[model samples]
Target: MQTIPDELTNIIASKSQKLAYQLRVAWDLNDFLATITFAVVGTSVVSGQDIVKGNAAAVTEWDKYTYENETQYVKKYEFIRETGFPLNSVIKSRASIVLDNTSKRFLPHALPFGTAVEIDDCDVATGWTQSQDGIAPTISTSRKEGTNSLNCGINTAASENTYAQYDKAPSVIDISSIADADKKIALFLYVKDKTKLATANAVEIRIGSDATTNYYRIQIVNSEILQNGWNEIKKAATKVGTPVQTAIDTIRVIFNEATVPASVTLGDLKIDYIRICDSTEEDNYIGSFIRGGRFIKLFSGYNAYSIPQFVGMTDRPKNNIKLAETIINAYDVLHYLETWQMSTGYLLEDHRGDEVIAQVLADAGFTAGQSSLETSMMTIPFTWIKKGQKALDIIRKVCEAENATFYVDEEGIMCFENRYHLSQSPHTSSQYTLDYDEEIIDVGLEPTEVINKAKITAMPREVQASQKIFEKEGASVINAGETLELWAEFQDDYGELPCTAITEPTAGGATSYFKGNTSENGTETDKTNDLSIITWETLGGTVAKMIFTNSGASKVYLTELVIFGTPAKVVKEISYETPDTDAQESIDEFGLKFYELKNDLIQSADYARTLGDTIVYSFKEPKKSLETTIKGLPHLQLEDMVTVNEGSTGETYYMYVAKIEKLAEGYFYKVLLREKVIQSYAIVG
Candidate 1:
């Protein structure tokens, strides 16, 4: 050790400094600090002298002091020496030293703390040999006054005192080859000028090669001392005062193939000291160094960033101060909250079933305060898309229709990206238009809305219960408008989707037109008591005009109808009403049902009472079934049930049940009818 001073600077615990700030307050936080000699050299190395020494290192925070990024950069100097009067005699020539992040000219990871050991600055010394452990040669020549010291800036170009010496800072000591060796090496560094930004400039003591290549480094403390006219970097480290920076670690290079390189420079240079000791003497680390880590909370789980190795820390919670602050980063607290929200959504979807789409729409921010268009394909019973204006209401119909987003093409046509699109029949003219000034369908990553011509030649469809028609006295409809509506209700070919509904009468029916006396146009009733529905009304006298209606070209096929014997009867019906259709494999708002009527010749006056709800009924049809199925209807209501098995008895009888307690006569309801009756009651359950 060098000559002992009158006072000893404490590296771990102290008595003098604490007494100086006796009145100062200490918060309720743990007083945590790393002991350099203790961690790096263990108990043996410090058995006599301090292998490394320092007071306090506090310049690692943001906004206080910063170092250059590139290991090298440029700077202009000031000329401050007297001119011409032999000023060259006293003025010194000093080499410029660049601060580089990927540099190692100083102590490998840091500078020797107590008193620094350096090699001779002459280029001719020993031809520049580096120890296998990376320590540069020791300096033997006497210190000489540097010559290139001058200041040249502004109006005054006089010779001014310089701060940092470019040729003489801390040199990095590289000993990476012994990383896994059974020896512990302690690195010492000299730091200075740790203060405010304008007053301090942090110098980096890089311990590695090019950023892309390898190693470690630290912010050289006391870099500001250079600006303050300090020449000897090693001399500054020996001062008994507050230290600016420090380091000790075992962490190796990250070696990321895809990480951005931080600024720092390095080049052909020399090394000086390498103090390697047996592993039994100490741990391969440097403690007094400010190399540290932090804890991070994550979404999938929680983890900790362990400290780097060279700084002497290898385990998590590397430091007490860091460990205490992150104690509350619990995982279940966040996981359960997220899970609860997702589960809630699932329950709502199941309870509301198909209506859940509307429920979701209700929460959408944009849908508020705006009226939606009615979709012909939708059973939405709203007034926005009333019949007789379907063409004019086409755009609005789509908006009001559920499961649709609005769209506008350049040609100025407002439309929807709905599959049930009331206007199922695509526009024959390619000149389809939309509002160009507004937002349109770019959903699902489609850059532009591609209007594809999809000719739906076939589909897996469904049919609804048969619709009954009553006779009214009026004119013979030119379009047989009432006939089209009636034929659909009495037949099976009208598919489920409104666009799939049958609008024309088939020629094969026993009586294609339910021809009867036309009724006087008087009153009407709104469609009520149903699951989902679309509404329509007759236009002129029996004309059944459906002009410009937004409910696009849709058809309705009544597969089965239920008539109550106690309700009102009907003949050939003349009123108009929107038809119910089939299952939407792709966002369809329609429904379909099927019934096996009792008669080959069904009647219109069979219904006696209007049921409260449509009974549940279903059937399966081939996916490719098209328009040809709407040919005829079964004309029966009450049929024989007793002793009726599958056979052509060729006998006709009205089927009914009555009882007299005198002597009850019982009969077998057809095995099929028995099953049907059981299902009819099952619906209410």
Candidate 2:
């Protein structure tokens, strides 16, 4: 047993001035080692290439590529770099997903399909007044279907020879919040005896700020007219007289009953329940985006393309580098990280407190790893790059093109990982292993969101169709220097044919002839087929011609006239393979969300589909959060893998740390972790 000194014992027993609680704590190299090794160990440099323990050196090259004649630069380097401890190692950081009481689906923007705006006094004459008419209309119960019918008698009609118009103020037709001028407002109503009118257009609806100018008019056609019984009608208002502007506020209903031919007359007209609503299905949200929301509303649901916090300033081209400006490249950044200064032949005495001091402090504070020479000296071969371009932009282009991720780990070191080489095996270090049940303090398991359908975009290589020969399917007889018309339909090629003529002389034993005034002919379509001919050109007009020259007068008969050319480009298609039929059926019933990627990163639709599947399966099919106590580690790192064990079932799970935050003065670490569901690049089955 160890005996404590009187002074120490007195301080421990004293209620005031607790030395243990008052001591300022600081983590040193020893504390770091006890928690997790910040420096690289399993990863090494070979021939100036950074390589991890299980991942081999993979390189990709892109050249001689163009987009609409504009050259593009693309290259990928699958160099495995580790910023955190070995995946299998038991580091101090513990993480899991926090499940909400309920799940919320995210969308891009709120779509207005049937958003309604009611019109006042549409069913009765109380909120309306007739134009230049002395008689007042009354509510007719005989014609009313729902006790909301308004009837205007024959005597109330205005201008017995012209028309009767009922007008409403701009406030009655709301158009203040409408952002899209092209979108139309629809009107729904029920009418009686519209067919008895004299003119073809018995009723007209207009929307505008003024009566004569700046308005749209829609006339109820004969097909939409109600004659014997009541008929419900719905139609979009059309532009009437030339408008001063597209903005509209007032609505007018006009009925030309006095224009009747004297033989036909509408004794009484009845109208019921008029309402205005938006029925535009097309999206009006072009070049408009909602930022800093829980989820970005998308075409079908909510989607956050990029998590802003995880995204860095170096990710954007304009922010990262500028010409004629003193900026640091990745090489200089790495070198600074290594020694906190640029490499020089001779060290300056007053190098301290230089301009680079700010950058050094701004950088994630971490010492150089083992492969500093490899990471700093590595060269990337790109198709094209601007002079003095930002090194991070080059890295981003390469990573995006190759389907890789570029991120700074919690250790403050940049790490690059190609999704193809994700399965490099867990870290071999024994310290990487952790007993989840014993070490985990508390855990939150996000309900898994398993998606069954995925939509992907890819530029798959196409097998071009050879210039096809579209023959007339019959022979034609013609004399030398005489023209004949022939009709033939070509599948894809329509403009012109490659060859001039494809015919043989009618004389026995006469050789076949083609265009170019030579014996040389186009390549044979099939060697096995005897009647194989190349192609024939049209007669410089709408139809193809067959003419025999006087040079070989042998009763020439045109057997075939064919045309040849390539097909149009088509997008590749792919299908998903689901293990659970029930889930697939549910997705089919509910309509799975569309996950589209436009960048031609993957070569084939199959690869794109697989990439989408990998992303959906790995990240948040079911997100989780974990909490753990690490006595030595001070910070949480991205992409750090931690083990979690279920206390009840004893099942183990390996989760990748996607996010982390410090709490209670760095005493605890809370992390948002994702599962390792993406096992392979392609479907094995």
TM-score each candidate: 0.15, 0.28
Candidate 2 per-residue lDDT, tens place, 1-685, comes to 0133455434333423311111011101011112232221122346744332321110000011110110011011001122221121111221111111111111122222334444433445675555643235556433212334566533433444455556666453554444334335443333345444535776777667676777766677666664433444556656656554434557667666633322222325555545444554332221101111001000100111111111111100111122211111111123222223221211111121111222222232332341111111111211222223343443443444445554543222344555443444432111122344443445666643445444455442222354444545545544444444444533333342222233332222223232211111323231111222233344321234434332333334554344443322223434344233424554555456344444332345555555556544543233444444322122224454666666688886776654454332322334555554535544233
Q: Give a tens-digit lDDT track for model 1, residues 361-409.
A: 2322113222232332233221111123222123222222222334311
Off by over 4 Å in 2: 1-397, 409-413, 427-439, 448-450, 459-591, 616-637, 647-651, 681-685
lDDT of 1: 0.20
- Regions of model 1 farther than 4 Å from truth: 1-620, 625-685
lDDT of 2 at 515: 27
Local accuracy by lDDT, each model: 0.20, 0.36
Model 1: how far is 127 from its true place, Å?
42
